[model samples]
Target: MKLAIVVGHNARSQGAVRPDTGETEFAWNSRLAKMIEEEARLFPRIRVKTFFREYCGSYRREIAEVYDQVDAWGADASNELHFNSHSSRTATGTEVLSSGSDASLRYARALQERMGAALGLKDRGVKVRRSGRGSESLMSGRAPAVLIEPFFGSSPEGQAATDEEHEQRALARSILQATQDAFL
Candidate 1:
């Protein structure tokens, strides 16, 4: 099976926070997204690719590139990386969003459960993002694509944990496990 892993946004973007400092969300998200794709390379039958917009481009540019790659290789699934942020320090959980397919929902659920289990966090549950705010994901043309938010920054729960590498690893492992459970 073919897979595309997309890092949500540029780590250096304005409002981005460093996980180690309890500020930046992309610090953990981007690294973990890369880790997931790298680990997927271990499976012989899975052809994995990664997409990101960190350097000299925009999300539009990066996703366009992803679309080209997906078209070229006929990717079967896509994973978009993101982190949850909230005003209250009480919110702490993981969630996944799909375009609207049973397979997509199942994949999201497995991802939510696995990541929640790995991080000992609350399972925020999976849902279809059909409204306006998530339009980027809805129109990405990457069918069966899901966006995962595993941690909530600015939350008291988020400030409690500081091991960026360990957090990233846990999330990446869940991503790999989800892919294996579904595609492999």
Candidate 2:
């Protein structure tokens, strides 16, 4: 199976109300992409591809290219990665979303479980998403795609705890483990 990973916005993209200081969406994306790539090296059956490593303009345009690139590469599955945030400080934990298709839902549930186990975070459970401004069209086609907000990265506790290298690696490991369990 081939997998395509998409990092969030540009390093300078307009962030939400609460953004991570000194950490751009691009930076977080690059880190997550690298982590996933490293783990893919361990699994021989699956190949991984990264979409939109660099940012120009027009997020919609870039996302379209990502979809085309993955489609042309014949990826069996595509995952769009991003961190979550809320206006309220109380919100926490990880979330996985599927297209409500059996396969996608299965992947979402398994991934959510693995991530929760590895991260020791609360389970926000899996949900099906339909429409959105930022949704990827790559998923709109033949490939199975889902958007993952692994944690509320902007949360006060999350930001404080996740700034360290060890914590980041741990989070990455959880994501990688979830990928292995879900796909392999």
Candidate 3:
């Protein structure tokens, strides 16, 4: 399978930040995406490519460019890495957003299950969103895509759960396993 792993947000507009550590979603997920790509090397059948959204001054155009690039690369499946955030620090869980297609739904479920287990977070289940914050990334590409929110960066507990190197490695493995199960 040809997999496109996109790091959520960009350098100019990094997504939610962990207050305590000041770790931005873009930075954290960039590292995770690289780890995922490295892990994919172990699977001979899987070809993984990592992407970062360019801050082109327009969010809509940037997303379109990303989808265009992914489509051009002829990816079979795509996953965008992100972490959830809320004003209430108590909110925490692992969830995946799908494009509402059957393939996307299956992919989302696989990711949600694996990531939840890897992170040891509450399973918020798969959410089908045809429109919203992450909808474009899920629906705009030719390949089936899912947006992963593996934990809430805003919550101390959530941060603690995924703050270690081992946790990140486990999450990377889970992502590849999910891709294999859902798409291969």
- In the range 74-120, model 2's lDDT, one tens digit per residue, is 97777777777877877888888888777777677877887677666
- TM-score, candidate 1, is 0.81
- Could you tell me the TM-score of candidate 3? 0.97
Worst 10 residues of 1 by lDDT: 14-23
**What is the C-alpha lDDT profile of model 1 across 1-184, one tens digit per residue?**
8777766666557344534365455556556667776676666677677766554556566556655655566778878777777666687877788777776787787788887787777778887887665446545755577888777765657545525667666667778888778767
- How well does candidate 1 score on lDDT at residue 91? 76
Q: Which stretches of candidate 3 lie over 4 Å from their true place?
A: none
Q: What is candidate 3's lDDT per residue for 1-184, written digit by digit as tens?
A: 8999989999999999988789999999999988988888777788999888999988889998998899999999999899999999999999999998889998889998888889888989999988878988988899999999999999988998889989999999999999888987
Clashing pairs in 2: none
List residue ranges in candidate 1 displaced over 4 A.
Answer: 11-23, 54-68, 159-164
What's the TM-score of every candidate structure? 0.81, 0.83, 0.97
Which 10 residues in a row give candidate 2 its minimum summed lDDT? Answer: 133-142
- Tell me which of candidates 1 and 3 scores higher on TM-score: 3
Model 1 lDDT, residue 180, Cα: 75
